[model samples]
Target: MDEQTAGALPVFVFPGSIDVIFTQPHTHKQLVTLYNPYEFPISYRVLCTAPKKYSVIEPRGTLKAKCCVDIVIRHLGANIRSNIGVPDRFRFEVCKYGYTEVSGRKDIAVRLVENASDIARQASLDQSNFHASFPPDGSSRLSPPQYAFPSNPGAPSSQSSPWLAVVAALACIGALMLPTQGDMMPSLLPTYLHLSVPQKLVAAYVLGIVTMLIIRPT
Candidate 1:
């Protein structure tokens, strides 16, 4: 949807993003979806940063459509519960009409400190957190508006970036076609073989494009 062509007034609402850290009972991952209301075009940036220090980790990149955006963060191999001592915070930066105007600048913060004891005691998993809020100053800071990741980690990693599927498939194919240890043919009949490298990549690109084409709130 073109922001310029969208309805007169602008409306935006997001349930917020998920943060997962691998550890303890299981691996965890979080996904956030957003709905956009505007008549002009827009570019959205989803960022997950260290709450205490924003620069510790730069904001990760993800694509957003004119009407909505989704963000996913994965906590890998280690128990997510381990991070109970640490808090995770995130921010969203949106540039619309090629930055001519900005819309829906928001932040989603998670508190691991308060919920740590419960997580360790029950060994229970929680995915609940705070309500999403907007910050007057884009800078990250401690405040009541912040939220916490409620559950221990559950997933190893966020799904690979949709854009990488194609390149990854091609890379795997090229690797397989090349000779391997002991001159092995590298299982040419592997299930992945059914999806040729180029074909797989093309399919991925199509899926991503289609996903954007059908962008809508869930």
Candidate 2:
């Protein structure tokens, strides 16, 4: 166990930044996740630099050991007039249970993203993430008409993912080849190139899954 002095300022791990987006006539919201990696239990409480600009749910709570918690931060009065040009943040204070001393502290920066293209990109990303949680057959796989929340940042990049699937497709073909067992066998090929029955089956299984994913309607 590490004893903490008042000067020691270790902090919990979380996304380094947050963005609150304002696109149209609606209340804007963003979510922040707090992570606790310690073995012992801890308590957390949040303070805002601009409290009137945002709403935080369950602003303080006990966090279990080695766990994660989601903090919903809604932009209060999220129209263009109120949130514009104002820099806001959430201040987090974490301390070990039963102790008054703060074990960790961090300040999270919040930005309001109002650009048109940026909002579209963010809405698309959020939809894709929601779809990913379900099976491939889920209707959410394609972007559906829906209200967008605070945008999540990931969008699948085509440059890397397709090449991986291509390799898997090739492996499926290679899996069909059998090891040279008789006089017809040649010595030129390396022994490692040979596919045993189990190896072949695994490759075939992988190919089947990828094939289905590729063929699925977008």
Candidate 3:
């Protein structure tokens, strides 16, 4: 591991650099924020190089632009760890000024660097209202609606249904009546009142009880 770390530093390579190779398994982290101002649209990306010789083996998803977004590098594959090296690279690009295919390739790197500056500045300053609701006088308030909290909550609570409860109760009663092959006279409960798992079982018991009660013995 020591020898591998020593060789990866100072020299830079592309298409899976040393950091890309030796990254830890099942580890990742990321941060994102909105770049859309009232008029201009914005976007960004950040690439972090481990300060020490470590590889970022595999990343699950593409880093995207938006507020409160984060990325995590899940360390995978063989040997990997965070050691002394360059601070992870923060790469960002903005189309707020203007974007062209030619300009995109030519100025992409510069945009990324500037993007970091813009993000840092925004972070340091106090956050203002990104959204609001209008009042009767055409004035606005910064607070969100009260019901929004319940509409999409983090965890769910239990709910009850009366019809489902009835069905479950009947099912339990039927199971308890199983042992006697539905013998009506042997039990105090009437055969007609019993629920059988097999409909035929209950029907036969009811008919036999009725016939015996109605008929005369020889």
Candidate 4:
């Protein structure tokens, strides 16, 4: 929705951009107040277009006429603690009741920080941060520090489990032994062959081990 066209609506969103700072594993909820100036009650639907991990608690609800309603945007810190440097953006489309089009929209920009201390340090306090300056000598000055989030070293990487490797090894060994054992025991081969390739391999190795133990009784 265009910001210029939003003024025509009877509803207004205070603090159009919802900014949130997450520093720990917990629930963080930010409130976005919606004011309805019409005399009749208006229903507003909040649509969040962002990662599934981030959610808007009261996404769809009605606002009383000539009153205000708070729309809550929430993020679970647990899901975000290990996701530093990943920015989550949400476009909230607020549509009026019975209207097929969006009446107003707000963009919620979320930045995940490693710690609480970084939140204050990364906040932009001056408008000058957006502009670059040059000296009278025509020499360019250094730009302001860019916002950076620390990576979580302890986060686990995507990898297969150790047990899966063991299972694969067992299956390979069983497959190799099946062909040789089947030749010696032709009658037994049919019974083993009835099973799938994987099943046959596992069964052959198990039976071979059992036969060796039985023959070497002590």
Candidate 5:
């Protein structure tokens, strides 16, 4: 599969990167969503560049028409100080339900951040890369224009730089990954993971501003 080339895959992936916090207990996991926007079912597999460093759940599966699958990827390596700042990546390959050949490919970076502020700064930067593009049928779990990717990235005459569908997706991923009111699921997430309604609202509002900054004209 690594030697194959693929055409446009109708699947959508979120966050653009999978970020795991480096800490003790090492229980935090990142969620990567694979969405099938087409009417037909699709088969997909996830591949990692650094296989020994992480573990993925549902690495291969079939997504029914207009459905999405959430992949749970956890950092499995020890917290090695020497590995900080290095990058890891995951590749997604998709094909029609019955086929073994690849139809399309998507890749996402993986980062292990040492602290909370690094995560915040990364999220802020991620939010400024939006351009809103919806699929043909217009049914989207995320109402924010399929995460707002610009239509063109190669047109020299265009004013706005076309980026991958992200920022908004990453912001939403952050919100989704935040722990809810439950002790059953233990995590390495910071103690301040809890948020009130107003606090959540402010977070959303701030993220909205970040999205505007990227989509807006310079």
Candidate 6:
């Protein structure tokens, strides 16, 4: 253990720089180990200045004295295409807490490199990976109807229409009266209950649309 005295405060020194290589396709996963040489346990945080493309595991954690922790680096396939020829530079800043006087900061630069052949191979692999991760089944795949809006010529003007506001206000009044109004409820309940499940569902959906249109700011 190497000890350095910084203005009377004794600091335990450890080796800092760690180099990591991430080859395309085959070697997408890489691990970095950080060792603490101090007698007491220390808390540390690992930070990177990369975009959402990179997934880092165990970036921040506590390390026991004289023990080491492994940080996993996974390159997301979505962001890898943008960093084909150029190296994706990630500066890892490991800062130690507890000791305010001593600046226990370690800076490590991890470079993600890929050759032309590797990039080509990874692209195909990424496509396959994406498909495998999200299977084209009803459970995993989202239907277009879930996200798509109704294609109506009158939709653009509906927002400004006073009729839409009236319909929305009626829907709100109906919703509020359904639970409280006893005499009107019996007649209305039978109308809703007499309809098939699908028809009731459509009615409920239309009511939701009306409610949304009413709440939406003009």
**Cα-based TM-score, every candidate:** 0.39, 0.47, 0.21, 0.44, 0.50, 0.39
Q: Give the worst 10-residue stretch by lDDT in candidate 1.
A: 51-60
Relative to the unseen true structure, what is the C-alpha lDDT of residue 160 in candidate 2, on a scale of 0 to 100?
61
Clashes of 2: 0
lDDT comparing candidate 2 with the true structure: 0.59
Positional deviation of 163 in candidate 1, in angstroms?
27
lDDT of 5: 0.60
Off by over 4 Å in 6: 1-23, 77-79, 85-102, 116-218
Roughly what TM-score does model 5 have, to 2 decimal places? 0.50
lDDT for position 80 in model 3: 26
Best by TM-score: 5
lDDT scores in order:
0.42, 0.59, 0.27, 0.48, 0.60, 0.44
For candidate 2, write residues 1-218 as lDDT tens digits: 22211224465646655655566533265667888878978887776655545556667788898898988777754565555534555566678888877667665655565754564455444443432332332223222111122133232222465667778888787766646334355667777767677777887898898887667664
Question: What does candidate 3's lDDT look like per residue over 1-218, in tens digits?
Answer: 22111111111112111122224222222122323222333332223222121122221122233322232222221232332121222222223233321111000000111222343343223122111212222112212212112222211111233344445545544555544454645666655655555764654555555444334252
Clashing pairs in 6: none
Q: What tens-digit string does per-residue lDDT give for candidate 1 at 84-161?
A: 645455555555545534455665554343333444422223223222232344434423112222133231133344
Candidates sorted by lDDT, descending order?
Answer: 5, 2, 4, 6, 1, 3
Model 3 spans with C-alpha error above 4 angstroms: 1-28, 43-79, 101-218
Q: Candidate 4: misplaced stretches above 4 Å? A: 1-7, 24-27, 77-79, 120-218
Query: What number of backbone clashes does candidate 1 have, counting pairs of residues 3 or more apart or in separate chains?
Result: 30
lDDT at position 203, candidate 4: 64
Candidate scoring better on lDDT of 4 and 5: 5
Model 3: number of backbone collisions: 37
